[model samples]
Structures are given as structure tokens and as C-alpha cells.
Target: MKTDPTYPLFPICAFLGFIISLVPISWHFQAWNAGTCLYMFWVSVACLVQFVDSVVWHGTLNNHAPIWCDIASKIIIGAGVAIPAASLCINRRLYIVTSVKTVSFTVEDRRRAVYIDLAIGAGIPVLVMILHTVVQGHRYDILEDVGCIPVIYNTIPAYPLVFMWPVVIGCVSFVYAGLTLRAFLQRRASINDVLSATTTLNVNRYFRLMLLAFIEMTCTVPLSAYSIYINTSGVTLAPWISWSDTHFDFGRIDKIPSVIWRSDHAFYVSVEMGRWIYPTCAFVFFGLFGFASEARKHYRMVWMFLAPRISLVRLNPRCVQFRIIGTMP
Candidate 1:
């Protein structure tokens, strides 16, 4: 099968995104809370997986690394849920800090909030991973350029089992974001006081967090809903069978042909969107926070650390001294 022209771009984009997503986590680590950390972690992991997948199976259905695919398939499932889960934590935290009732939070209250965020951000994804087995139609599907992805039987149960969590989490996050926005509007004059009293956020970081959550919710909810609609509509799904029959369906492994993907416009759109969305999210995140004053400080520190080392390996000593002498004039 001829390779899609866009296939080569996947690995490059994913790899760049992976690198970009790591900047805040590695450099300005202290600026983020558990929720932001979790979100970046999920994005980085997903980008790494996509990078590997694109490199391994670009324009081919060769299962070069089956073991890796097994692990990656599961990671993809968890990552899908974890991202929105993390966003929920962010919005929920904003809601808590902005609530009028939270006049001042003690250390214990802060610890409790962290625990709650961890539970929602990390716990729910684990639960979803376990629940995914019920609707998993087969081992996995190896698609050209996309590598291995879990196969969910488009049965009645799959809707609740696998497809709904992102939308559900997104909707809940929207509610929290709405509440937070209302609180902010009402307390605009004293917003910094409200945040400083309840959390570590200053005006800048607080608004950034809010904007991040809002944008993520707006994108995730509609995309997830549309994904569900496209995957379900205009297709005759296999009848619902017993859990065993659905889970252990015959032909446990399959390689999707590229023609099948290209033939259907909606299917193609969904597939491409799934492939590109994580990198897009990473880029969006970088755009939102990568240039913050704290991030820039980290950037300067990184440059400072690297500059001396780079200067030590002078390609042209004569040119370097000449440049130094030029500065004297």
C-alpha cells in the first residue's frame, strides 16, 4: 500500500511535542501543582508513545515490536482518560480556591485537596483501564502509521464502558470552570487576595490555569462527542453478546488496510484527528505556558548551563578571539 503523504509528519510532530511538553515539568517544576504536573506527564507520555509508534510502523502494518504495542495500547487508553481527569483536577482546584466559603485554608486542608486531586487525576484512569477490558473486542489493531490501538467493540456497552468517560469528565470540568469563572467575576477586585489566601497562585498563574482548563474543556468535549458520533453513526454494529464472546471474539489480532481507512471520509478524519490531537494539545500547552516569566527564567538557566559547555568546544579559536576583539571597538 502506498504511504499517506502525511504519515511522515507524525513522528516529527510527536517527538517535538514530547520535548516541548517536558519543559515546564523539568525546569519550572515548583510553579506547578499536582494537577498541572499530571496533565503534562500524560501529554508527554502520549507524545512519546505516538513518536515511537510512528517511527516503528510508518506507512507499514509491520508489527515490528509486538511487546511494545501491548504496553502502548494500554497506555493509550489510560492517557486518554488521564488528560481530562487532570483537567478536572485543575478546574476543581480553581473552584475550591475561588469559592467564597474558603476564606483561608490550613495546611491540612491543602494536603486534603492534593489527595483529592491525586485521586481524581490518577485514580480514575486506573479504574477506566480495568473497565476497558469489558468492551475490548480484540487484542489490538495495527494501523499503518498509527501502530497499535485498542479495539472497542461498538456494542451497546462500549458507549458507557469506553466512549463516555472523556465527555463525562469534560462536562464536569466545564461545570467547575463555569463556577470558577462566576466566582472570579464576582470577586474580580479581590481575586488576587482570594487566590493568595487559599492557594499559591498569583494573578498570572491563576488566570493561566483557568485559561488552560477552559481551552482544554472546550476542545476535548466537542472532539470527544464528535468522535463518538462518527464512530457510531452510519455503521451496523455487531449485536451485543456475552462479555466472553465480545472480549474473546475470534481473530484476536488484525491489521487494518490503508485503503479501508482512506475510503471513508469520516473514518479517515477520526483516525487522523486521534493521531494528531495529542501533539496539538502539547503545542497548545506550550503556547499557553512555555513563555511565562518563570518558564523564561528556566530557559535562561538552561541556556546558561549549556552556553559554557558549548563555548568550551570552539570550532574556530581565531574567529572567537576576533569576535571578542571586535566587541572592544
Candidate 2:
């Protein structure tokens, strides 16, 4: 297997992202809403999977751990859908908070909102995972330094079954984000009152959440669109096919030679983009929320909890040396 100089960077970035994404989840566990938590959870999962996959398969195409690859490949597919779905939940929540006509939200209304967010954030991805079996071309593909990836047949059914959800969810997220922005602009004077009355959002947190949703949608839509175009362009398939033919053709399934991927430019670009997207999102999330006042407080709490123990450990070595010398004398 041929190696690329850049292969090593994938694990490093993915590992960093996995760690950075976990900070908000662990530190601000109670502070973040379900949507934000779900978003970070998917990010963490994707990054961790990439980190492990890259480290194991770096500069090699051998399927050393086929079972791990199988599970990771499914996760890779689910996470691609889950992240955008979570963004939609966040945007939708903001839109509701900003556009509500009622002056106060009831407990049932808050509970209902949480339920909807959870449904969209968690439910849709599970549905997509079930749907993906229809288009899954083969068992999986193991690329040099890229590890195992799901093989989706680029066909008419794959458009709706696999490729379009991210773009579609992203478009919906964009609409919600736009409406939320418009509502925020129109009610800037009373926005704080509305937020305090309706939800746990403060002005800064509200702005950051809105901005994060906007950014994620903006990135997700176009990237997904481009990916679809690249995957489908110049390829001709029957315009219509029977479900049996298009569905996972287990009878004809076989391993693709790893060397073939080395020369497939389009596939390489797609894989490269997929590898970087989660880490980039993680970095962006860290830039946005990693240093906020609440995050800083968590950091201080962690330091305070660890500092005494660390000091005692450091002092114990010297104390041990002194005790040994005294005993010898």
C-alpha cells in the first residue's frame, strides 16, 4: 500500500477533536440543552472513530480488524446524518424561543420541546441507519490509511436513501436559522425578556447557539450537495430499478481491491473531506464555546480538584527519599 505524508495528520486531528468535543459534554453537562449535548456527542463519536480508524489503518489497506471496521462504518454513516439533524434541533429550538407569541412557557411546553428535539436529534439518524441498508453496495471498503468506509451504490435510490438527507436537513436548518435571525433582529429590544421568560437561554448563550447552528447549516448543505454531485456525476445507471436489484445484493457482494482506491481521485476527495469535516467542526465548537465563562469555571473546578492531589504526589517522592535516608542512618 502506498502511503501519503498527510495520513498521520488525520489521527492527530481526530484525536484532538475527540478530546476537545468531550470537554463541553463533561464540564457543562447540566448547562447545555439536549440539542447541544447531542451535537457534541455525535462529534465526539465521529472523531473518536476516525482517530482509531486512522491509527489502525495508517499507511495500510489490510483489513486487520474486520468486525471493528463493520461497526465503525455503520457509525460513520449514522454520524454523518446525526450531526446535521442535531443542528436542525438547535435551530428549531432557537426559532421557537424567539418567535413564540406567548409571554410565558408552561412546563408541558418545555417538556414537549425537549421531546421534539430529542426525536429529531436521535430518532432521525436511527431511521437513516435502517434506510442505509437499502443502498449499501457491499460489506465495506478498506482504503489505505483511511480504514473501512461504507459502500453506498451511487444509483437513483441512493439519492433519497443516503445522499440527500444531510442536504435536506441542512436546508431545513437554514430556514430555521434564518427565521430565528429575523425574529431576533425584530425583537432585539425585548429579546432578553422573551428568552428569560421562555427558556434557560441568556443573551450570550442565545447568540452563540444561533451562530453555531447557522455555521453548521451553511457548511453542511453545500458540502453535502457537492458530495452528491461528485459521487453521481459522469456515472450512468438505470433510471429505475427494482428494489430487489438495488437493495443490498448480498449474493454479488465482494471485496474491492485496495489498490483501486489509490487512483480514484473522486473517492479520495470525498474521503478526505469526510475525514476533516468532524475535526473542523470540533475546532469551531471549541473556538465558540470552549472558553466561555461557564467553561472557564469548569476548567477552574477541574484544576482545583486535581491540584492538591498532584502536589501531594510530587511531594511524596522527596518525603520517601528523606525517610529512607533516615532509616539507613
Worst 10 residues of 1 by lDDT: 314-323
- TM for every model, in the order presented, reads 0.90, 0.88
Instruction: Rate residue 134 of model 2 by lDDT.
Output: 80
Model 2 CA lDDT for position 177? 90
Instruction: State how far residue 175 of model 1 sits from its true place (Å).
Output: 0.7
TM-score of candidate 1 versus the correct structure, residues matched by position: 0.90
Once fitted onto the true fold, the runs of candidate 1 whose alpha carbons sit more than 4 angstroms away are 26-32, 101-103, 249-251, 312-329
Best by lDDT: 1
lDDT of 1 by residue, 100-195 (tens): 665576778767877887899889888888888888888789987678887778888777878899999999999999999998888788876676
Task: Give the Cα RMSD of candidate 1.
Answer: 4.0
The alpha-carbon RMSD values of the candidates against the true structure, listed in the order shown, are 4.0, 4.6
Q: Count the backbone clashes (under 3 Å) in each candidate.
A: 0, 0
Q: Show the colliding residue pairs in model 1.
A: none
Return model 2's CA RMSD, one decimal. Answer: 4.6
